[model samples]
Target: MNLRQIEIFQAVFAAGTASKAAVLLNLSQPAVSKAVQDLERSIGFALFDRSTGRMVPTAEGELFHREVEQTFAGLSRLRSSAARIRDFGSGEIRLASLSALSTNIVPKAIAAFRQRHPQVAITFQTQMSSTIRDLVAAGQFDIGLTSDEVDATGVTVEPFAIYRAAIALPEGHPLCAKPVLSPPDLHGEAFVALAPEDRTRQKLETVLAAAGAVPRIVLETPYSTTVCAMVQAGIGCGLINPLNAEPFLGRGLTWRPFEPALYFCTLLLTPPGRRGSRIAEDARTLLMSFAGERPALPADLHHVPEG
Candidate 1:
């Protein structure tokens, strides 16, 4: 009739006597017998053979017992799954990232995070920085990686790491021979630029404007990877984050520290009104660890020995 009644019936059936069931269930014998009787009455049949001195199940009782066994088994599994989630031993983590970081920083951090949280389901999406901020604020993403700090209405932002932006040039470009470049050195070169609204675009524009050097803007792309590829193709030279520029440095492209070293700082963004999400915090820790005390060079970066 109810879980309590079912439990009492199970105890009585297992113990083979109402007196023994009452002792096992910590209830009086009368209470156990009443519960069993109530269950049988609700089901419209006798569940046991009363004439036998030993408790024996009727055909109907055996059929009911089969269902009760299955029901209790399912309840046991449900509690176990709930416990696992509550303990943070298993769950899904959704992440979002700016296009630049999606290809470089995220993969490494995810690799490290997976080693520890192998059971956590992880999903990733890539979008522009502004989109990342909006989604994270709306609780669509547990964690977001962005190049610039995001200050949306319902999101918390934390500084993760900073890496210098450098000039990327074709291997044969004359500026590659310069030991240290100033804005004047890059003047008049055809440029491959990020979208005008991109954070790094504003920073680089300011640096170039201050030096009175206007680049010949020929190509524009939103992703850092595309800018680096164009630079490698000799389409134009541009300033880009080392993490994005380093990988293509030696493949017919050279990276040199920009004169007024424009540094790019990565920000960790999370939904507000939550103290901390296990997934977001884990992502933050993983990114910071990959960032390390020192900045990361692009994957193909090589430190040339000093002259």
Candidate 2:
């Protein structure tokens, strides 16, 4: 009938007598008997036969008890899971990030977060920086990692990491001789350029144009990983974020500091009005910590202002 009736019925069935059920449920025997009577009346069935002052369950009562037991078991499990989630942050954390960060930085942060909260689940998605920002603002994701080029109208943005651009070159390349490369040094050199639509690519183009230097553009793609791959294959040298360049090291790829530094800045994005779950906040902290541990670039390198 109702949850209370079902609970009393279950207690009576388990304990075999009204007085014993009352003791188990911390209720009076009269209250337990009245609840069971009301449940039988609501169900229009004789749940138990009273004989010799002992209650014996009818066939219908046994069948109903089976279903009630199953339902109660499910409720018990739900309560346990809810408690676990509330106390230990053991639930799904939805994370969205740019394609570049999804490769190395985000994964490293996830690994660190998992070490502390092994039961917490994670969902990671990769999209353009704008898309990541939009999804986070829409509350579709708990956290977002993107470049500073996003529109921060409906989202809260914090500086997550600052990476200086580096020159990625194939081993034995002539530019490898230079400890730090400037735009003029790369002039006329075959270059693997980022897609024109990329914000970082536009900034880099502006910097090179101001320096009166132009590289012989060989290929263009949207992904930083592809740029690293092309450089390793000797297609051309590339200026890329250091985080993207880290994994390609010692794989026929080497990185040199780029002069007149152009920073590739990443921002942490969250919904403007809502606080994130404990798990999401912990993950954000881990990501920031990982970024901080990366080798610091030169302090004297000139910073390119955000346009």
Candidate 3:
């Protein structure tokens, strides 16, 4: 009915019980129950099937809750926009990033951005490639960084950084003694394949197939950080983007560049047709300036016109 009632209804829908909602909302169970009843009465329908001291959303209630969620999301964005207007330099920028880039590349970019706009609040979430793309496209995030190339229908993607792929080998692995490793060097060796959907794995596979090599895969993981850990334990060697592999250099692991070069570009994705807030625009500029010196850019970016 009202914003307060809508908020209470959402909490009840989420918590599934008046008592639990009460605890979450810091209200008494009766108060929570009263709020939900008031909302259902205002809507001229029962919002829940109340039988066993538990709340189960009615079919209409479920639909109503989904709408409420969307409404609240829009309200939150509006609130953020208003706060930005009150203080242009200080506002929240929500971002989602693939796990590999989240650890280093994204953090480094955020660090550089914060140096200039110290008042801007940044919230970063690390997720798998698909999820990051989805969140950004859904307006849940202002920006997304990922190694994967996304074909999101309403999102604009721009290359932000390039990471050369490297192979991480256990100290005793045969490739450890080699200064450089070619695809042939990895031939028949046991490997830790990243998830089949991972951009890094696909690139590595392309290079391997080109070099007439089919590796013996021994492990697979979604997280590059976990793959690094697996390599440290001698579980198997892995091919990783340098951004994720660089920090694991000396912990019983050795890294060598793949002979047939493999690399992935880090892309910054934003919802289409939506300009970033001023602070976000400034942050993007900072990111571009810092990322320009990284591997992904062509040699001529120094002279290229700015976007």
Best by TM-score: 2
The residue pairs in collision within model 1 are none
For each candidate, give its TM-score against the true structure: 0.74, 0.83, 0.64
lDDT of 3 at 209: 93
RMSD (Cα, Å) for all candidates, in order, is 4.5, 4.5, 14.5
Residue 166's lDDT in candidate 2: 81
* lDDT-superior candidate, 2 or 3: 2
lDDT of 1 by residue, 200-303 (tens): 67988898899898989999998878888999998988877767765775688877776666777778888888755565577678888877544344334355
lDDT for each of the candidates? 0.79, 0.83, 0.77
Native-to-model Cα distance after best TM-score fit, residue 160 in candidate 3, in Å: 1.4
Ranking by TM-score: 2, 1, 3
**Candidate 1 or 3, higher lDDT?**
1
Off by over 4 Å in 1: 1-77, 293-307
Instruction: Give a tens-digit lDDT track for model 3, residues 1-307.
Output: 7899999999989999999999999999999999988888888999999987789999999899889989999998889768776766447788888787667667778888778667577898998767788888888888887765556567888887776777778876877666667888878888888888777688788888988988889888887788878888888888876556556666676666666667666788887788677777776776677665433322211331221
* Superposition TM-score, candidate 3 onto the true structure: 0.64
